[model samples]
Target chain A: MDLHAMDRYIKSLIKEAGHKIRNSFLSDISIESKSDANDLVTNIDKEIEQFFISRINRDFPGHRIFGEEGFGDRIEDQNGVIWLLDPIDGTMNFVHQKRNFAISLGIYEDGVGKLGYIYDVVNDDLYHGVQGGGAYYNDERLRPLGITTIEESILAMNATWAVPNRHFDHNGTLKLIQDVRGIRSYGSAALELAYLASGRIDAYISMRLSPWDIAGGMVIAREVGAIATNFRGEPGNLLEQDTFLVANPSIHSRILKDYIRQK
Target chain B: MDLHAMDRYIKSLIKEAGHKIRNSFLSDISIESKSDANDLVTNIDKEIEQFFISRINRDFPGHRIFGEEGFGDRIEDQNGVIWLLDPIDGTMNFVHQKRNFAISLGIYEDGVGKLGYIYDVVNDDLYHGVQGGGAYYNDERLRPLGITTIEESILAMNATWAVPNRHFDHNGTLKLIQDVRGIRSYGSAALELAYLASGRIDAYISMRLSPWDIAGGMVIAREVGAIATNFRGEPGNLLEQDTFLVANPSIHSRILKDYIRQK
Candidate 1:
């Protein structure tokens, strides 16, 4: 596949979808609850997801889409050229914050990530990566992840880690938090990944994320020499959802082996 | 006092300081260790603080200056017009993230906050508030915060809460985390406050923050009917360093009275 042509096409499509989202902002947003009361989905979310799905079906009929809104094919497996998309990664942030949310899309062929794209709609910052071409924020080439220890690294972990919860041993995560230089948690997983690719945050850890959540970020991060996998240091389950740790390659294994444990 | 004049002047000063920070990016940053091995102090931080101090003193010598760097006066009491300056509110973010940091400054007279400013130094976005006049983002005038409850509100919290650690009761904070619609932490107090003022995030909570940390944010937050206080639901100690919890007035008392407690 001509990766450059694919990248350009994806970027143009994401930009078009972003324009639709921006226009929807001026109109009234009728929000709805899904799965749970706290888990929300707005009309615009469904609209944008459908827009992308239809376009992809027309452009690349062979492409399989795994999207948040059930607008695409049922993707139970990571086979073929799968496009995992989160039209709006931080839905809460987008619905309320009106900024910081992003469009996240990752293309994986034969269960291996081939490319990733995360476009921060409002800022117009497009972070993209092809398997070997490396990541780019806009047109500038991104450098590989810098070497840094946990003591010197700034991490992006939500404050939820410091509090007790069910996913992981909250205590263990908090201990890791104190050990790091600092901590941050932006509501959007996609933008957080863009930041990690840009080396703004040395590492990112999140539990209970779907494949679409980390797909785009992981690809871009890998381009910058960052490593991403499940907590157990095994290959991330492309089909089953689970806890995740994406960090500087040097720190990934140690953090997984030393700190992370399943509850 | 001509608050309008003061506001204009301070805005210009902040923009100038922000410009200096922007230009610093073009050159090599000479960094040094401060309080700890990982803790950093950049020449740009010092230069910016010094620039604000010199400008304020030259025009208003009778006024006192309380800055992060020692360049500002040794402020004991808020007797006369005092400028509380944090040249870089999220210094760690500035040094490591190179983004998500801001220049925060708050002007108080006889212990009453008169004006507040938090400028996203990299993006050139400025949040400003005068006591009576409403808050603003760049040039857009802000409105008073609409009342919101815990369940409906989006919270900006450090991500460590889900894990266990010192400071607050991890479990209780978790309950607080679940009680909110969503949680976010940007790693910058000033930007968080600006978000609060802009009605992006409904509230903000931090374990331990100094005077300069929340001073500017408090002013802008106040203009939008957001309450600025400590965890005790009382007037926050302006002179003494303390933890910060600034939120919409409707919910500030509830969080302080029910959740946050002294260790």
Candidate 2:
């Protein structure tokens, strides 16, 4: 598929969705819990997800979707064109802080990511990428990520990695926590991945994330020469949830082999 | 002695210092490690700290300075005029992100906080508080913090608390992390406190902080009726380093007794 036209259409749709969200932010909107009280979803989240899914269904029929709100189709495999959508990536941040949330979307073709977008709705910034056509923020073409050691790199990860946990070897991740220059957790996975592309954060690692949580970010991170892979160094699971580590080219191998990869 | 005059002078100093930083950013500025490579202090941080201390000493001759750099006086007591300053509150963020750091300053007279200031140098927004006059963000008077529960509250804390650690009961903190409406870690203690005062975040916790780290923020947090106390629910250490917990009034006692209070 020719990406130029697709990219333009996606961008317009994203901006439209963002405008809708910005307007609702000032009005009366109800918020509800998803799986738990800590997991939040606003009326806008449902509306936006439905809006995107409906648009895709109208524009490109039979294209599958894997969305946070269950508005998308039942995606079985990464067989064909699948659009992964996280209408509001950081719902808790959106519902509570009223800032720091974003709309995340990614397009994959034949089991491979082709394009991605992460829009910071409040700030009106857009990060987008085509598989081979380097990432761009607004109109500026992003340069490849710079190389740095973990000690010199500012990681966009929570301090929780420094503690013991059931998922990863807590002790090893903790060592990485102390070995790095600093750690940060911005509460938005999409924004964090976008930052990785922008070189604001050298690397981002999370123990577990769903497909919608990272689809858009994975494409953008790759455009700037960053690598996105699961803990086992396999290509990330687009059909299922798994651990993720996105980092600069130089540090990805080191982080996976030295710290995050199991002993 | 008048807080209004002191606040005006401090604000001006902060603006001028910010101007100097803005002018010098990425222009022959030197940066080096303070403790580790990740902990950076640019020539700007040192220069800014020195500049603030010199101005304070000249304007208020007998005032004691407690600042990030060693230029501040060795403050041994809370008596008399004590100025706490963090030249660059999020030094790493300033060095890396160039957008999130701020200049944080707080003043206490005779063990009573009389004034506080947090300047987002890059954005040119200032949060100041004069005792009994109410907290102000930029120029708007801040409303009193609302009473809220841990389950319903948003917490601004590093992600490490969600995982197990030795400093405090990590498991207990993790429970609080899961119980709260949301969790955030912005990497700047001062701005986090300002947000707490303005009710953006209901609570903030950290394992260790210096007198200069939170001195000004403690005052601002207090004015909004938020509880600014150490983890033990004792008075925050005025002379030495200690764990800090500042939260909304309704949740402070519960957090202390439930999560932090040692058996």
Provide TM-scores for the models: 0.96, 0.92
- lDDT at B100, model 1: 86
Q: What are the runs in model 2 whose C-alpha is more than 4 Å off?
A: A159-166, A261-263, B159-171, B261-263
Residue pairs that clash (backbone atoms under 3 angstroms), model 2: A159-B160, A160-B159, A160-B160, A181-B38, B106-B216
Cα deviation of A161, candidate 1, in Å:
3.4
Residue A64's lDDT in candidate 2: 91
lDDT, each prediction: 0.85, 0.85
Off by over 4 Å in 1: B160-168
* Tens digits of lDDT, candidate 1, A81-171: 9999999988888888788899999999999889999999999999998998889999799999878888888788766555556767766
lDDT (C-alpha) at residue A232 in model 2: 93
- Interface DockQ of each model: 0.66, 0.45
Model 2 chain B weakest 10-residue run by lDDT: B159-168
Give the per-residue lDDT of model 2 (tens digit) for A210-245.
999999999988988999999999888988888899
